[model samples]
Target: MLNEKKEMPLMVRQSLDQTYDVIRKKSIKKKRTFNPQVIIAIAASACLVVGLGLSNDHVMASINKWLGFDDKGVEQAVNNGMLQEDHHSVTDQGVKIAINDHFSDENKLGLSFQLAFDHPSMLKHVENVSLDYRLKNGDGQYIEEFIPDTKPLKGKNRYTSFFDYQNPLIDEKSGMVQFNTLSDSSEGTIPKLKDAVIEIESINIFDNTGKLKKINGHWNLSLSNNKKAEEMIQYKIQNVSSAIQVLKARSTPTALNIVLSLKGIDKERDEKLPSDMVIVDEAGHEYRIKGLRSVSKNNETIISANFPISSYNQHKKLELMIKGIEKIHLIKQ
Candidate 1:
C-alpha cells in the first residue's frame, strides 16, 4: 500500500510536466511572450491537479479544462503595445507647429513646425510630411500662400544686397536672400498661388523614436490669427505718389521733398532714423533722411528726398518704404 502511495505521487509529478509542456509549446507556436498573468494561470492549473489527485489521464483532462486549453489558442495569449494595437487619442497626433528661417531678411518668411504623436517613432518618417498655409482677409480672399514641402520654406540661397532695391537686396549691409535644394520629386503640377483662407492637409510615415519603428497617418491643419510675420515690418504705405507729385511739381521739378514729420514716429527721433541710412524717392534721388538737421525735436526728417521716379501723372503712386533703414516716410499733411 505504501508503494502504491509513492506511485501516485510519481504519477502526479509526470502529469504536471505534461501540462507545462503543453503551455510552453502553445506559447512558442504563437510567438507570444509570457507575462506574470500567464505564470499565475499555470500555477493554478498545477494546484487543481494535486488537490484532486485523480488518475493521470483524468488529472490531465482537469488541467486542460482549468487552463481553458480548448478556448485559449495562441492568438489570445499575445501582448502588443498601444501603438501596435492601433489605439490612440486625437490629442496625441495634434501638436503645435512653428516655422523659422534663421537666415532670412526681415521680410522673407521662414517656416517652422512642431508636432506630437501617439508614438515617438512617428517623427522618423517626416520626409513625406506636407503643410499648406494661407493668409486671408475678412472676405475670405487670400493674401499669401505657403507650402514647405513643394519648395524650401525659404527662397533662393543668394546673398542679400544692401543698396539693391526690389530685386532682393535692401542694402549692401543689412538684407539677405537664400535658396534651398531638395531631393524629393515633384508630387504633381504645382498649385496656383492666390489669396485665400488657410487650408492644410498632409500624410506621413514617421518613426521619430527609432529607424525600425514607424507611425503612419495623415495631418489636416487649418489656422488663423498668425501675427508673427506681420509684426516684422510695421508701418508700410504702398502708394506715396499723391503727395510726392505735389512736392515735385512745386519744388525742384527733379527733386522730391518728402517732409517726413517724425512726429508720428512711435519712437524718439534719435531712435527712429539711424545714421548712414539714406532715404531715396522714386526719382533715383538719394538723400540722408536721419541726421541732426533731418531730425527735429518734433521728430521730423525734412531732408531732401530724391530717387529716380516715373513721370506718369496717372501712375501717381510714388512708393517710399523702409528697406535697410530703421524708420522713415514722406510727410504728407
Candidate 2:
C-alpha cells in the first residue's frame, strides 16, 4: 500500500488516498481484493475535480463579483481594458479612505475610491463628502484652470470623482495670436503638463444636521494620461448661415468637453446661448450635457460645455449632436 501511494502522481495523490480508503472498506465487506480498477477510477475522478476547480474564467469572475466591482463605471473600464487597480489607503480618525482605481486623459481625470469606517454606524451619518485637490507638475507648478465634480456610487462606501481640466490648444501660435489680438492686459499662458502630482488638502464631510466635519490628511498621487482612450475632434458647423467653430471636442473616461467659439457674435448674444448639446458615440451610446460655462479670452467667446460620460473609454470615436441651435440668430457688433 505504501509503495502504491508513492507511485501515484503528486497532483491527485491526496484525493486518491481518500477514495482508496472508501473502496478498501467496500471490498473488505464484499470479501474481495483491493482492485486496481478502483484505484484508476478514483484517480481519474480526482483529476476532473481539480481541473474544474482551477478553471480561469470561473475563478476570476467569482472573485471580481465577490469584490463588488459590478458598478457600471467599473464594469465599463474593466471590459474596455482601461481599468487601473490601485489599492492605496489612508486612515484618519478611524475612517479609512482608499484609492481603488483611476482613469485620466488630456482633458479630465477620474478617481474611484472606497471609504470604510471603523464603526459601521458612522456610514449612516455621512451626508456628503468633498475632496479639495489640485494638480501640480514635477517642478511643483500648479495647474489652475479646472473643475471637479464628485458623486457617490450605489454602495455605501464607494464613490467616484472627476476633474475637468483645460484642453491643450490645437494651435499654440493661433492661440497666442488670438489672445494678443483680443486683450490689452497680459495674462499667463496655459501650460501643458501630464503625469502631474495630485495634492489633496482635506476631505470635508457633512453630517445629518449640517455639522461640518473635516478630515485632514495629505495624500499625493501620480497618474499617467490615457491618450489612446481619449478622442478629440474638430468640427465646423453652420448655424443660421453663420459658422460656429467647434474648436475642440474632447472625450475622456468620465466626461466630455466641447469648446465652441462663435466668431463675430456679440457677447450678449452668446451669453443667452443654450447649451443643449448631446454626444453620441460609435457604439450608439448617448450622453446628455451637464454644464455650460463661458470663459473670456481676449475678444473670443469660448463656451465650454461639459457632459458626464462615465463610459467614454469604451468607444473609439464620438459625434457631437446638437439640436435647436440652428434657430438662434447671431448678432454681429
**Considering every candidate listed, which one attains the maximal TM-score?**
2
Evaluate all candidate structures by whole-model CA lDDT and list the values in order.
0.24, 0.38
Per-residue lDDT tens digits for candidate 2, residues 1-333, read 000010111111123234333333332332222223111111110101111121222332232321121123324444565545555666666655555555443443345434445554543433334445555655556643121233111122111121111111011111110000000000112233455555665654544354555666666656454345443332333343354566555444434446676555465565344434556655677655423445556666666654544433544455555464432221111
lDDT of 1 at 24: 36
Tens-digit lDDT string for candidate 1 (192-222): 2122223333322212221222223333323
Against the hidden true structure, what lDDT does model 1 obtain? 0.24
Cα error, candidate 2, residue 322 (Å): 5.3
Locate the minimum summed-lDDT window of 10 residues in model 2.
Answer: 177-186
